[model samples]
Target: MRDRFTPLLAAWLRLLEPACVRCRLPADSGLCPACVDALRAFPLPAAAADDPAPVRAGLCWSPACAPLLRRYKFHGDLAAGAALARLVLPELRQAARPELLIPVPLHPARLRRRGHDQALELARLWGRELGLPVAAEALRRVFDSRPQTRLSAAQRRRNLQGAFVARAGLPSSIALVDDVLSTGSTVRAAAAALRTAGVDGIQVWVLARAPGRPTARLGSGHEQVLHEHATEQSGTHRLIGFEGTKAVGGMA
Candidate 1:
């Protein structure tokens, strides 16, 4: 009799659990197992051949992930952000270890509006998990330029000109952390600022890489390896079935 009632008790408990934020299904954790696997299977971005600083991203940006990221970035959903940070840990561990982690700073005005710094939060989460130090104030966004999401590639580069300034006393090697990578403008600008301050060996780590048009110029032979890997995994997005769901509202 006890064994027969165990199944019923488990079903009742599941009904009482909170729903998954991504799929709205019964899940005690913010994300269900299926959603987690789907996100893990997302493709990695093709390495940018032009950028000198090597880039490593946990997953490629797509419609399935846009809502989840928007919720964390725009709506102050710390839970969602924590989930993303957890997902990116494996990629971070496999990359070249850095002495410190520096989060791309937001302009003061933008920080005031958003109420929290998503990049900083992610850096903190990773630092605790990886036992690495984070220098949140090493880099500052001096210029409050327009958002890059709406700008053309050229405009994005122009907007970030002199946008970042790094202070002295930084470590020789560090990884710059951010939520997403689009045209690579933001990290490029940030890396330039770090280089100017005499810091050497910079790497970029982001949660997702937004799909962009192919570039004409290419880097070394390593670019071909990354491109081929990305191409093979390009179809992985089809495994995620969240495309038809209602959009989660947030700024890109």
Candidate 2:
């Protein structure tokens, strides 16, 4: 072996423990202040829903803010998750203000594959920050469905129909937590299940909200595979490969 690459290898090893998640700057936390500021500016306009409860999201999904979610969602990056929570919690604390936080449930299979429910993690983080209680078992994903990418709003709704079931002991008023609110189908289905279970008044508190509709309606069969790949590198997932992200129906 030669010494030609020693300096580069040393520099990479030194940079392994970066100070900032996005900018690679010197900082005490996962994200530096500059990156945080940039992220703050990506909040989308609040959207209205026709469910039993209203839905609110903290940030708009953009290149700057969207990719950060993959780190928290699939790579087991709790610090990244915390940074994302810091962004969404303030909005929910001020807006939804529900005393109970209900993380959207994952299907048992998906839960096993992903190793964690991103929504549950977010709910716990928000609960701690807002001094609220998190009821992660309030709802359940009764069945699994196809990956949500490339589906239309109608198809998304159809895919999740009868998929979620809310349990008893859920509070009368609470907010449902999810990582990304895409088309809103998942939350709607979750909310409907809760309502059917006699729980009243639901709100959606999600971290990122995709800004507009997908460019095309072409159905791609790579949704689940892409998710697995995203988890492998933490930076490879793009607009179509959101892991904890939801789909094409009306979002909360």
Candidate 3:
């Protein structure tokens, strides 16, 4: 009798659910199956040949996925955050696994405003899925820097400098987990801190890689800009271009 009503219960739940965030179609989940397929089908850009840190990402950042991240990161949508983790899991499973997962820490002030740390949330979700332990306290943000979204690459670097400090007794090899990778300033600084704490290996993982362009001259021997080039195809912009990176990686 219970099994007989299971389908009906599921159907009723679907009716009461909200529409898919991306397509505005009725969906039990915030994201529909079709949108998930589209996200999986998006072509990933080639890794930067000169990138020092091994990086893995689930999707390329675009207008299509930006709102999902914004909702999760800024608006405190745990469901949206779970959707993103599901999307990124496959890519992370393919990469080199670390002894532990460490999220880029949030300053106390920002944590108060946000109510939850996005990176910590991602790390916990991933830790449970991947069967790894999360060292949430391994790293701490010593400074409460301004937001990095509107800042240039140089400014981003300056803003995040000395922002992270790692605690002792961290694993020799651990992956730094975050929501997105853009200019990479944040992760580079974080990785540097871990190095200072005597960690030997670091892997960077993120849900998406945002498009960026090198503002500094390529001839200056500075970090080259990695950006996604948009090509209009079939009424949608195809995200194709260089994988964005700096000296390392971070979410902007």
Candidate 4:
């Protein structure tokens, strides 16, 4: 049976190649202890303080989180995706008892290029672990939008508008899963689409969030700085301190 073969294959893979799933560092834990700790170190905060949604995130987005996600998404590293999702599961467990799990949908073009949807994979794995139902068809991306990484929060919001729509007959309560949350634009847009379809309650789940990351600016000289922050390409925009604890008055 395929199920029986899975364990045997896993054992063979382990015997033949024993290394951390992401970086390939020597380890039995799938990821090195140091990398595991580093990935797990980021705090998971409520979406908001007083009116927080029934949501939970595993870690904060940083250089480490980005690289792992990029490797899995761009490099076809299924092992790393599973390992990262495993790390994300503990916090996700706190969102217990959802009626269904909906991974954020990707546009057909991106999905075709990547050959897999990382969020859906994570959601399916998480659902299996929690004895919950995974509904990949409940939501769909109706429109393709620009990448959010380069846009400001406002621009990101604009880009994501009308990007998602929930299919008919989805349960009223459910959890939306994704790999990361930058400015919350995509999630919010997806949530809005779900609400429009009569979904009563929605919870957004992401593996990592960029805490206190500034929102998109309207225009003027400030726009350039905002773009730079959002871009924050390698060798730039390192996290110097906690939100509001350092420069930019907590605007990330």
In the order shown, the candidates' Cα RMSDs to the true structure are: 10.2, 8.0, 11.4, 12.4
My TM-score estimates for the predictions, one after another, are 0.76, 0.76, 0.75, 0.74
Selected candidate, larger lDDT, 1 vs 2 = 1
Q: What is the Cα root-mean-square deviation between model 1 and the actual structure?
A: 10.2
**Considering only N, C-alpha and C atoms within 3 Å, which residue pairs clash in candidate 1?**
none
Sort the predicted structures by lDDT, highest score first: 1, 3, 2, 4
Residue-level lDDT of model 1, residues 1-252, one tens digit each, is: 999999999887666566676887866556789988888675676787876488888877755566677666665666677767777788889999999999999888777666678799888888888889999999999978775544568997998999999998788999999988777888899999999998999999888886564222223332332243223221111112121232332211
User: In candidate 2, residue 115 scores what lDDT?
Assistant: 57
TM-score of 3: 0.75
Task: Give the runs in model 4 whose Cα sits over 4 Å from its true position.
Answer: 1-15, 49-52, 214-252
If candidate 2 were superposed on the true structure by all CA atoms, what would the RMSD be?
8.0
**Candidate 2's residue-wise lDDT over 45-104, tens digit each?**
556444335767777766676557766676555556666777566677678577688888
RMSD of 4: 12.4
| Top candidate when judged by lDDT against the true structure | 1
> Model 3, range 115-154, lDDT digits (tens) per residue?
5677988898899989999999999999888766457878
Name the runs in model 1 displaced over 4 angstroms: 1-19, 214-252
